[model samples]
Target: MKQEPSYIEALLPILTLVGLLTMNVFFFEDTLAGSNQVALLLAATIAGIIVRRNGQAWARTMENVVSTIGSAMPAMLILLLIGSLAGTWLLSGIVPALIYYGLDIINPRVFLITAVVVSAIVSLATGSSWSTIATIGVALLGIGKAIGINEAIVAGAIISGAYFGDKISPLSDTTNLAPAMAGTDLFTHIRYMLYTTTPSFIITLLIFLVIGLSYNFSEAVVDVANVKSAIDGAFNTSPWLFLVPLILFVIIIKKVPPIPSLMIGTLLGGVCAVLFQPHMVSEIAGNVPNYAEASYIGFMQAMFGDIIIVTPDADVNELLHTSGMAGMLDTIWLILSAMVFGGIMESGGLLTRLTQPIINWADSTGSLVASTVVTCIFFNTTASDQYISIVVPGRMFRKSYQDKRLKPEVLSRTLEDSGTMTSVLIPWNTCGATQSRVLGVGTFDYLPYAFFNLISPLMSILFAYLNLKIRRYELDEIPVEERIN
Candidate 1:
């Protein structure tokens, strides 16, 4: 690292991060738990050291870190709340009950389409792809596999649905993050993204449906007996228990802060446990001589920490588990490290350097759209962090879009199309690894099936070249298929 550097020179730390993380993903895959996070931290440290050597106060570097984390606190809180919400929802029967009902209705022949459609409905309803995935996506993966649909296709369908929500739902972090970074607001970003997102998503759904119709799925619908029995034996699964998540949903819809909303959700789940799964509370709280204290301690621990409900059936244990706030620590740490790396790149002026060429050469609207899409995908491939992918591209291209008299929405939409959607396809990306691990499918296996992802970039390019539904820099410019690329 140099003490004094030009904008291009500042990119060295970013390159170091990219190189180290790429090596870890390809050469040392799955052997290290947080190698990616450590790589980000290491990169940030190098940047800080460089700054310090240049006579910049250490306080300045530390302040940047603090500001970065501060900006991210809301997203981090939402993630943690989602973890707790997931746990309690499982305990309260919202997740498993939905899974049970879902398994019962799905036809083996249309499993792929069903996966995509159902996940879309749920994610659209909840404004959360992660929640939809963690609860329904996991169950669908198992069901789709049993139905003989390719695991990749099934995972693809799930991802497609999840990301649809991430892109369109005003509640999603990335949905919010994109506009925030671009100096645009959330609702505007979401509304504009729909221009590209809706079309690509529809095309993806059609592809899944066509594939489903073509593929032979002869396997029986999951008996759901083992899983149901496991859940039944563990928690008192009932419709009344659904109130927990229903209330939680209401709170989220009301736009309460995530921390408070999650706290309420956890408490309600514990209350439901007391009413329905008291024995579970007792078991989780551990044995004690006193009844009330044992119940209180056990329920509290289950709410704030780890709780596992034992069933005579092994499958029940898998479903009836919660890590509460603790479960989110790893993901949170990863995001923080990623932010550090991102902050360094931003502060060091490396992110600006990375996209300068595209910004300079994108003369036509078509080339501009293509350039934005390509740059976002490039960041996903090179930066190895989706947040970086979005943040860097959004920041770099903001001026270019405005210079051309295009609305910020265009750039924001392009960011989601190329940045958010493609991140899951890269094996080294955090989204890729997490989803792959969660669904028990490798990124390679799922890449082809991720039709929306595989196809969206193409769609973006096609739209750019054809100028179909393409708005102009001037609002008065007629929307039509214009010059072809």
Candidate 2:
């Protein structure tokens, strides 16, 4: 007895969510603290009411909501593990060592471009932007800050490179997921994506390079020496500290699942902290009688609570603190709230109703690809999950491509071009929320500077309109009369 809701009924919840989120920007300095979560919940309530009125049972809606949230559990768990890893990495002198060494080697004039390239290499190797950002990206941001670069711009560069690698790397989940959804193989999708991705990346690098070369680094040189001094005085910055990250990278490359890999990395970091930097650990333990007890307390504190390593230089002190597993709680809350809103809207068929018009409007090759890109972005915004954005749009557009004689790789590449690239730009989406928390930069703060991400979808759309690099089915496959074009 379910009936389809009208466009107005379907769009009401989305409009409400958008208006609430916009208001949060003006009213709250830190929207993620609680205001955004309230907005999502309020939107969900409105969607739930409309769904019930449209004859969808509340029981069924609740079931869908649970299932949707369950899908996000792994990401939430990874966020917590990343928090522990950040804390332990700091205590072990790994992150500090990276910054301390990076200061001497990386010139401020090229730091932004270097951050991009380094982050891209790491992400391509791991095939996981989340891990890359949490690990090397954290160090790069610190290096940039120490050298007087803007933290938001540095974060944007790191994210741009990380996502560039994630989009084309064969090991990436989204890279594999896109082709699977579009009836194509992995390598074919990657090969086709490079047609658009390469141009976007080159432009991104050039922008970063120009920005990097424009910086006034005369003052940063003084700060770098002082920062290095503060770090040298605090913990042992041995070259051996790098072994932890190398091992973690090995585990990731071996295709060990993210959870176990991050867990092993976290434990390894704790052990390194105890062995290499007992003084810092002992201080964190606070008045404990023996080295053993101090190690135990310090290790526990670094995994589960906040740890601050103060230094003579106040700026270094700010850079040297970690919030452990507790820091990821707010992000987890935001993810859950977003899932609630997405679930209710999807379970009631409201999302489909909203997208149907765009799908119907596609009359040409350019319009078809453009529609797919818009749908993917729309899903990222409304569903607040990257996987959903790719999966739903891929399903919706597969038949349309077939009817138009477009090869499956065209659809698959477009999926990654837009779906995978833009997810981190939206504040409520899981990628955006997690990266923002990890990097300590707001989504909007870095949106304008995430050049690669901003340019990718446009590149895809441009290629479509220009009929560049677009593959098609064999001409002979069509009937003689149907091929009359």
Candidate 3:
């Protein structure tokens, strides 16, 4: 006989998972190296056991797990390509050139705010925060480091702006997905979101501006010249190197799929390395006499293995090494492990079981929106994927909003404010893990500093409680069937 899980049953795997992950922090210095992945797998096993005991077949649970992993395949592939792209870009001097030129033009006093604005514009234009963070965000971090700012704080600024642009951009997948899940039109959701989003973004910028101005850059000024000189000595820091990223941005804006766009970027970076940094390429190839063999060997190494460019300055050398596609394997392992846990919990209805009380408690309008935000964050933490966070909560709350005569855009906007924004804050979530690996900054390290992300959900709740711009549907606009129900 089939049995429905009790609340305790639903909570068991999650509690166990959280406890294990917490223990991992104390036990391992680098948790993501393997410990975190093991923790996820163990948690999935516990969930699988519960599902089987609840009368779901093991085969069925495995099927769901397979489907979930399949869905994450695209993300895993993109990570690999990004790793390769970073490697080749470094080899080609594109990254160094950006850092070199950026140091010359960007004032250390205003660099944090500038990073935020620059990342925002790029993310807004491309409608992809991932691409923006991987390419330009990496360079910005290097520039920030050369100027003596903490990498975590710089990463926070980059993520804040990137996510801000992603949340509002018409082309963003999450922006589109939120509306679809909540039964709202795209433009309606976006317009309604500005009421809360605009304020949060303004506050974020103001905070960064203040932090930027407070910094004393007297010492960093000396280091910047040394950094630029080291980069200039190692590779050709030509303006032409900027063309590779410009072309990548154009392809992203033109709506080419992410995988193909990343692949193209990686190849273009390789070509640029051969054309513009031939001497360095030969050096990377162990100074082989034949230029053709050296080019082939260097390009292959940049795409798949460790590549380093030693510079006179130690800080510059730190910025010049890359691990290529092989480095992304740990992140991929984490994603697959997370998906396994998510699949089991979802297939067994454990997540819904756990969230039922939250929905039930959402009687008042303010509480309803608050509940939605909490549920979305909960899902982001437990499910380890942002799309699941939006989809699950949006589906759960859509009817509740309609029943309360709230506009669907309210639900959509709340979903973005919480779901889309907070996913990158959770260490195990796909967005968080990928960004951490890409930027070489830990998720928790930047969480406190990602002001925009930290503020968005609170902003959403504040609006709902204050009845400020909380749009309600006119009685006439409510469907007759819903009114009767």
Query: Which candidate has the highest TM-score of all?
Result: 1
Quote the lDDT for 461 in model 2.
Answer: 90
lDDT score, candidate 3, position 390: 76
lDDT of 1 at 212: 85
In model 3, which regions exceed 4 Å deviation? 108-202, 208-220, 361-450, 459-485
Q: For model 1, which pairs clash?
A: 285-298
TM-score of 1: 0.74
Q: Worst 10-residue stretch by lDDT in candidate 3?
A: 476-485
- Global CA lDDT computed for model 2: 0.81
Candidate 3, residue 267: the lDDT equals 96
Of candidates 3 and 1, the better by TM-score: 1
Rank by TM-score (best first):
1, 3, 2
Q: Model 2, poorest ten-residue lDDT window? A: 476-485
Candidate 2 regions with alpha-carbon error over 4 angstroms = 108-203, 206-220, 361-450, 459-485
Q: After superposition, how far is residue 237 of candidate 2 from its true place, in Å?
A: 0.8
RMSD of 2: 8.1
Model 1 has an lDDT value of: 0.68
For model 1, what is the alpha-carbon lDDT of residue 295?
67
